[model samples]
Target: MDMGNRDTIGRRILIVGGTTEARELAGLLVDAGYEVITSLAGRTDTPRFPAGIVRIGGFGGKEGLARYIRENCIDLLVDATHPFAAQISANCVAAAADADVPLIRLERPAWKKPEGATWIEVGTAQDAADALPRGARVLLTVGRQELGPFLAYTGCHYTARMIEVPAGLPDDWRVIAARGPFTLEDELHLMQERGITHLVTKNSGGTQVAGKLEAAVQLSIPIIVIKRPRLPKANAVDSVVWAHQSVTRIFRTG
Candidate 1:
C-alpha cells in the first residue's frame, strides 16, 4: 500500500500489542503506508493476529528488548497492551528509555461504575477475593491466569467466563466458555440463569464486553472491580485515532 510518498513510507514502528486498540492501531499504521510490526505476549493458546506483520512471544526482558530496538531500526514504539499487563508495560518503559527510542501508549480509559451498580473497587485480584462475601454466587470474568488468589475463597461458588475452560477447576467453580461483545440481553440471561449475586472483573476498559456491567446494574448485583496498576510515566493517548494522528505527525516532522 506504499504510494511512493516519502512522508508515509520507510518508517519502522513496533507495536507491543494484545488488545483491540492495538489491532486497530496496527491497521491504521499499515494503511498509512508505514512499516508496522505487532508483538503479542504469547500467553493465549491462540491469539488473534493484527493487520500488519506479527511477532509472537516475549523479548526476554528490558535489555533484550533494547537490543531488539537497536537491531531493528525501529523509529517508534507504541504500547497498546492490556491494562492489567503491568510487567510488560514496565519493561517497555525501561527498554525504550535504555534504547533511546520514543514511546507512546495507546491506553483505553478504565470503565466507570454505571448508575445503580454497587461497585467495590480494589487494587488487585487478591483484594477482590478478600472482599467477596461468604457464599456469594460469583461471576468471575478476570480471566484464567488471575484465578489463583480467588481459589482460596472456597466459601464462594464461582462461574468463570473464559475463551477456553481450564482443566481440574475447583468443585465450587464452573466455566462458561465464551468470547465477548456480549449483548446486554445475553448477559442478563446468563446472570439470571446462573443465579450470580456478585461479579469479579478487571477494569480493562473497552466497549467490547461492557454489557456485563450494565447487566449487573439491572439485576442489583454487586461488582468487585480490580483497579488498573499504576504504570510508569510515558506519553499516552486514550484513543487509537489520536495515536494514529500522533504517528503521522512524527513521520511528517522526521
Candidate 2:
C-alpha cells in the first residue's frame, strides 16, 4: 500500500471528529495544505465544521467506513474522535486496515495537579457527590450525562454547567445552559454567583475548556476530580503536530 507523496498538491484526510481537538486538528491540517474532511456523529445540532468538506452521521459501521475509504480514495484516516469513543476507534482500526488506508490518532493531553488546590480523585459521579460537604453548594462541572448518578443524593446542592438541556435533573438542581471556552473571570463569577464551595468535574483536558479549574482554585473550592476515561490501546500520537509528522512519515516509507 504505497500512499505516496502526501506533500504533493492535495492529499485527502478523513478526521472522525465531534470534539474540540478534532476541530482544531482539522483547521491546522487544512492550513498545512491538506484536503481535510471532518465527519461528525450528528448527535449534536448544527455542528460547526472546519474550513473544508463536512460529513455527518456514522459510516454505517466498519464495513460502511471501509467502503467510504475505498470509494473516496482516502489517503489518511485521522482518528481525532473523542477519547471515550472506543467503538468508533476500533471501527477505524478495523475498517482502515481493511481498506489499506493509513490511520493515526490525535490524542489530547491529560490534566495534572497544581499546588494549593485540594483535589479528591473519584471513580464515579456518585462517589463525588458523596465526598462533598453536607449541605455544600456544589458546582457540578461534570457534563450533564453523568449527573443522574448524583440526583439521588440530597446532601448537597448541584450547579451543573452543561451545553444542552439535561434530562432527569431533580427539581432542586440548578443548570447553566451554555457552551464554553469559558473565561476564568466568567467561571469565577459563576462560581461565586452559584455559591460553589465544592466542585466536581472530569479531567477533560484541553485549553478550550479548562478555565473552570483555575476558577475553582482562586475561589479556594474543593474539587472532586473524576479521572479521564481510558482510551483504546493503539498507536496514538499526543497532538495534531505528531499526527502530521506521522502522516508525512507514512507516505515517505511507501
Candidate 3:
C-alpha cells in the first residue's frame, strides 16, 4: 500500500462520504490537485455532496466495492462515514484490503458529556428506551433507521425529529420532519414546546448537531446518549486538517 514519494500529480483518491469530515477532506484533496471522488450511501432524501466527483448508492458489498476501486484506479481510500455507520466502515475495510489499497479513517471524536450535563449513557436504542423514566416525554434525535427498538416503549411519548419519518412508530409518539444545523434557541424552544424531559441521541460528535445538547443542558433535561459502536482500528485522524496533512505527506513521500 506504500506508494512512497513519487509523482503524485494525477493520483486518484476515493472518500467514503456522508459526513462533514468527508466533504472537507474532498475539498482539501481537490485543492491539492488530486482527482477526488466522494461516495454516498444514498439513504437520505437529500444528502449533501462534496466539491469534486460524487457517486451515490452502495457498492453491493466488499467485492463490489473492491471492483469499483480497481476499475477507478483509486490510489487512496478514506473512510469518513458517520460514526454510527459501522457496517459501511466494515465494508470499506474489507474492500480496501481486498483491493490492496491504502486506507485511512477521518473520524470526528465522539462527544464527551460535559460537566453539569445530565447524561445517561447507553449501548443501544433499546437501552436508551429502558433507561428512560416511565411516562417521560422524550425527544428522539437518533434518526429513522434505529427507531425500531424504541417503539417497544409504548408508555413514553416520543417526539422524533428526523429528515424522513419512519413507519410503525407508536401512536403515542409524534414525528417532526426536519434537518439539522439547528440553532440553540430553536432547540430550547422545541424542548419547551414538547415538554422534553429526556433526549435520545447517538454520541455523534461535532458542533453541527451540538445545539441540542446545549439546549438540554440549559433546560436541565436528562439525555440518553447511545454510545458509538466500536470502529475497527485503522490509520485515522480526528480532524479534516490532519487528514489533509496525511494525504499531503503520503503524496510527498510517494
Among these predictions, the greatest TM-score belongs to 1
lDDT of 3 by residue, 110-205 (tens): 888977899889998889888988889999999888888778667878899998886767676788999888999999999999999998999989
Against the reference, the lDDT scores of all candidates come to 0.89, 0.80, 0.87
Q: Please, what are the lDDT tens digits per residue for candidate 1 over residues 1-254?
A: 33222233568899999898999999988987888889998877878898888889899998888888887878899999998888889989999999998899989989998998899999988999999889899999998889888887788888999887778897767788888889999999999999999989999998889999999999999999999999999889999999999888877887
Residue 193 C-alpha lDDT in model 1: 96
The backbone clash count of each candidate, in order, is 0, 0, 5
| Count of backbone collisions in candidate 2 | 0
Best by lDDT: 1
Question: What's the CA error at residue 149 for candidate 3, in Å?
Answer: 1.6
Better of 1 and 2 by TM-score: 1
Error of 1 at 8 (Å): 9.9
TM-score of each: 0.94, 0.86, 0.93
Better TM-score candidate (2, 3): 3
